[model samples]
Target chain A: MALLILPIIIPFATAILSLLFRRSAAAQRAISLLGATALLGAAIALLNVVWSDGIQATQMGDWPAPFGITLVADAFSAIMVTLAALTLLATVVYSLADIDVRREAFGYYPLLNVMVMGICGAFLTGDIFNLYVWFEVLLIASFVLMALDGDQAQMKGAIKYVVINLIASTLFLVAAGLLYGLAGTLNMADLAVKLRDVARPDLVATVAMLFLIVFGIKAAVFPLFFWLPDSYPTPPAAISAIFAGLLTKVGVYALIRVFTLIFVQDVAYTHTLILVIAGLTMVAGVLGALAQTEFRRVLSFLIVSQVGYAVMGLGLYTSGALAASVFYIIEDVVALQCLFLVSGVVYRLNRSENISVMGGIYRTYPGIALLFLIPALSLAGFPPLSGFFGKLALLQSGLAVEQYAIVATALVVAALTLFCIGRVWSDAFLKPSPAPGSAGVLVRSAALSSSRAQMIGMLIPVVVLVALVIGIGLLAEPVFGLATRAAEQLWSPSDYIQVVLGEAL
Target chain B: METILAFVVGGLFAAGLYMMMRRSIVKLIIGLALLSHGVNLLIFTAANLTRANPPIVPDGAKQPLPPVADPLPQALILTAIVISFAVLSFALVLLHRVYQAVGTDDIDRLKPVDE
Candidate 1:
């Protein structure tokens, strides 16, 4: 119970403290670090508790589940919470050296804390309406963070991000409202039980599809992804890393949660829809990446592409497939963050995010180049890395389902992703620096102390993440077992309802 | 009553979408405002329309909520309105800064460096 609530409470409390001590940079950093560390510890502890003793739930204010908000930490939520907390801690450290300290000291840390709170809350909540609340909390924080620098690019990005998210939030609200009207309940577990009793299958399917569209926009799937690449790159590197690591994954997590639990019987239509979208998302995302010459822009496109792998697993609709999707999501979040952090280093070294102007950086920053290589190759599904295992599992599962066309397209898209990332490597690191670059001067100066600090701070977490990915890859049996358990829990949903409502309907 | 409210909400949603697609920053703000209002109304309607009274307990009553409005949706709308207000203000400030920095409110003028 304590562990379930601490991840949210720690950050929120620290955010308030940060605001009160905004004028003191030292105090702000201390508070933020403390909060992040506490969150990480809490998340890990919760994971242990859940692993030892199944799923856990705590009703806020001691009210029963149906009438009061509940914070539930299942295997899936536990893992996501831990990942979000760890990424947040790393981003905080990265921001210490990278951010314009004097300008951002007051608001940035608080906003980041609030954002983490929202994310953790979103993962932990058991009420549908409360999930919407957490989404708004995170979205609002992201809007401020996106526009933090208040530059032209940031503003443009912020506008598009906000408008798209606002629309998505509205859609989410409408879906929740409709669901509540039909079921007369807003509690997720209760709704799952009552939804089974509802006679209108079409209405259930309609509301479920509406939810997919809303969450789809957030996850940057297929036609809904145009806003992501356009907006994400403009934020500062720390914010970008956190966003890359956590935001879309939350949407994906929600999609898995709702679809698997509430709409399990509609797998034929839903899975097919997901399959078609997944294929298109992968192909289109890589194509977008191929068309980009900018470092962050290409990374953004890859985010969309990687998301398709996760969606593909869900579409396959088997225990192995769902587990693979879970694995892919975790791998994608870690690998994407690593690549984005490396891109930040590239931008710092070259003073340009455009690949056309960046060259021979690997010679100057071998360590950073290597860090970038790990995630890049991993993302391309290279052997021995986490990304390879995730893709392998997804592809194998798709084949098992005899989704041969999807399997073939996924493989082709994987190749294209490899090509696109290789292009980024060549253009940005291997090739000679373009002579008389228009973006900026090509004066190869030693890295700034601040930049070096930022790089080291960022690299530590990437290293940790990569090592974890490798661990998961090596010990796939246990991890996949846990994921299978989670999938079973989701498929049945009886335990979830029993835990929340004290008895299954 | 529910049908009329739904039509009004739908019209507002269409209008908001149209305004959001425009190039002007001010129009975008207006669009968000309209969109939020529509969403609030939609939520209200989804709670099932009731006209008798607000959801409040009467003195010495066991369960005094017959034909009363759903207080949950109303509370949620209140929060949404507050959040949207904050977002709108922040957007206004950001737009002001963008205009000052770039000398234009036209999104087209803010094209990517590659473009």
Candidate 2:
């Protein structure tokens, strides 16, 4: 039980300590960094335990499965917990030099830790209501983080973010209520068995649609992603990096969990809709990126586009496809965060995020430029990076099923993604600095740090993440193997239920 | 009661949606508040309401008495109410901060500020 709840407890405890130390920014940072390290340690422990022990679950207060809240960490959930912790670690490391004193005093570190708690909790919970609770926890923390600085842009973005997510949360709440009423239970494993035996299967499908809309908004699928690009680009880059890396992926994780675990009865309708949305999300997000000149905005759009790949895996509903999606998310969480952090570095160096106005950064900081190139190319699905193998697996799986239209859409979007990435690279990193009196000309020289220590504080996390992006790519076989095993677990969810609800159920 | 509540919920949702689309930040917050109320009411209504006594176990009783107002929906709605309250307050405070910073409640004006 301690092993199961340790991920949540560590962060929640860390957050409380971080908030208490908010007066001294250095203390807060140190506390949070320690908390993040502990969080990572706990996640690794949970992962190890789950690996050797099969699914580790502890019913809260020992009330047994269907009655009490159950925290369960299977291979998939354990992987996500570990990923969330790692993202928290990177955000803590990167924020040291970036997050200003005022924002730090506003308890930014605590909010980030709390948000990580919510993410890991969402991943590990075996009860649907607990999932909703965790989502709200993360959403609330994200709202605070998104509006941390309370500047015009941050507030404006946060308003849209809050309102839209409020709508989605309301929808989620309604669905949860209705699902509970229908099945007389909100325990996910129990509901899995109970939903299968429900009298009105169509009602289950209706509730399933509600879930799609809810998770769709969170996942920022096609036609539901307006809030993401609007909100994501305005936050501080460390905040944006964490948001870009983890928030939507939590939604994606929820979609995968609910769709694969509980709502499989209507796969024909639900999965096909997911596939369609996946293709459109890819196209829409990349096209949106192409039209933008802002660094974080382009990255935000790519984040949306990449989610489509994960949703596409869910849409394919095959073990191979699902495994690919799992691998894709892990790859994305690492590299996308690196890119966002690199954008921060870009802005930090040149005092601008407008790629058109950004130049000579590459001239001054070759290391930073290299940091940008790795994730940028990886996100563009360049060969020998993590994204390449993930995309290849997704493409192979799609082709195996002969989903030509969606597959073709994926191919076109991939090409467009590369084009957009190239556009960013050429405009921001490669092109010569524009002359005075030129369009979007910038006079700001690269702020080669007066404080090299602060520069290293920010730069090292990006470098570490860049190394990770390369590491996952080079070690693809073992990673993909783990993903496949996780996928196999999803394919046979009965074992999950048996573990949670026991054999009789 | 359920029938009346359903219509009221729909009305609130529509009104909230309308207000949310307005260009004013204050209106946006109001809309969010309305939507919050609407959703709480929705949870109450969607779960098959009953007009029975409050669900409290009697002395020596193993479970709550039958038809005791289906306490689960009430419990769910209670939680929703608390969460929505927290969110609404935060939204309001955030809007207040925006107004103080930008000196405007108009989202159209705030639009350019984002860039």
Candidate 3:
């Protein structure tokens, strides 16, 4: 019970402390690091408890299950909490070097921790209405983070982001309200039980579609993703990396949770709709990536495409497919964070994000090039990397289900993803230096201004993340097994309901 | 009462959507505000309306009486109102800062970030 609440509490406390120490940059940094470390520890501990002890649930204020707000952790929620903590730690370390001092003093660390708290809250909350509250918590935090610099591009990007996201929030509120009207309860497990018995399954399905659209916007699936490429590249690389890594996946996580747990009555209609969206998302996102010439923009589009693979797993609606989706989400989060951080370093060197003007990174900083290469290749689903196993699992599950259409789309998208990454490689890394307007000769001179301490601060997180990715690849069996276990837990909602509401229900 | 509020909610939603589609940034903020208000009302009505009876347990009772109002929807609306208030205020400030920085209130005048 105590374990279930610690992940949310640790980050909430960290954010408060960081906010109080905002005037002192050094103190803020120290507090932020300590907080992230503690969060990761709490998350891992929680995961350990969930792994061995089945599922854990605790109601707020000692209130009983159906009427009170409950926090619950199954294998899936625990794993997500752990992954979020890991990403938070990496982003905090990277921010030490990547974020300017002015931004740090402007409450960056506090907002970051608060955002993580919101994310962990979203993962752990067993109440549907509480889930919406967490979404707003993270949404508001991210809104500030998006416009933290208040520059022209950031502001412009943030406006679109805020407007579209606000609309999604309102829709989510409506969905939750209507759901309450239907189920007479806000607890997710209770909703699952009641929704299954609701006489009008059609109304339940309509509400389910409302949820799909709401989370789909948050996930940036196809036809709903234009705002993503525009806004994601505008933030600082550390901010961008964390947002890219965890934000949409939360949307995906919610989709998986509600669909698997509460909205299973009409899977034939809803899951099929999701399958179509998944295929379209993959095709459209990769195509968008193929069209972009900017470094960060390409990465932004790739994020949209990668989200499709996770959604496809949910769409496949099998235990194996869901496990594959969970595995892919893990690999994608780490790789995307590393790739964005690499983009930050490269942008710092070249002073431009344009691929046409950027060159000589491979020759000048082979380590940086390798850092970029490993993740980029992994994202492209190359063999011997974690991405390969993630994709292979997804494809195997797809084939097993005879979902040849989406499987075929996944393959073509994979090939195109490789091509896009190659384009970035050749233009930004392998090509010889362009004329000395700014990129080539200036890179070496720019290196001098960035203190060695800053460089260490930057490279450490990148190295750690890359190493983690490679470790996952090498140890794919254990990691995949863990994901499979999570998928098994998700496949049986009865276990979730039984644990959360106890046998009384 | 539910039927009346349902139409009012639909009307508010329409007005909000229309305002949002306008090219002016201020209208966008107003639209956002209206939309949230509409959602609050939607929740209020959707939860099944009750009379003025309060959702309080009497001195000796363990739970509220059978005919008492359902307090859950009101609580949900209260929370939603606070959140939307925060978000709308932030959006307004953001719009103001955006105008100051970009020197435009016309949404189309702001250059696309992709450029």
Top TM-score: which candidate number?
3
Which model scores highest in lDDT? 3
Task: Name the candidate that leads on DockQ.
Answer: 3
Cα lDDT, all candidates: 0.84, 0.87, 0.91
User: How far in Å is the alpha carbon of A417 misplaced in model 1?
Assistant: 1.1
Residue-wise C-alpha lDDT for candidate 1, range A204-252, written one tens digit per residue:
8999999999999999999899999989998777789899989999999
DockQ of each: 0.61, 0.62, 0.80
What tens-digit string does per-residue lDDT give for candidate 3 at A244-338?
Answer: 99999999999999999999998888899999999999999999999997899999999999999989999999999999999999999999999
Which model is ahead, 1 or 2, in terms of lDDT? 2
On the 0 to 100 scale, the lDDT of residue A339 in model 1 is: 79
Give candidate 1's whole-model lDDT.
0.84
Docking class of 3: high
lDDT of 3 at A96: 88
10 residues in a row with least lDDT, candidate 3 chain A:
A439-448
Better of 1 and 3 by TM-score: 3
On residues B1-115, what C-alpha lDDT tens digit does candidate 2 reach at each position? Answer: 9889999999999999899899898888888788878877887787777778678888999878777776777777888888888988888888788887778888778562333
1 or 3, greater by DockQ: 3
Candidate 1: misplaced stretches above 4 Å? A436-455, B52-54, B65-69
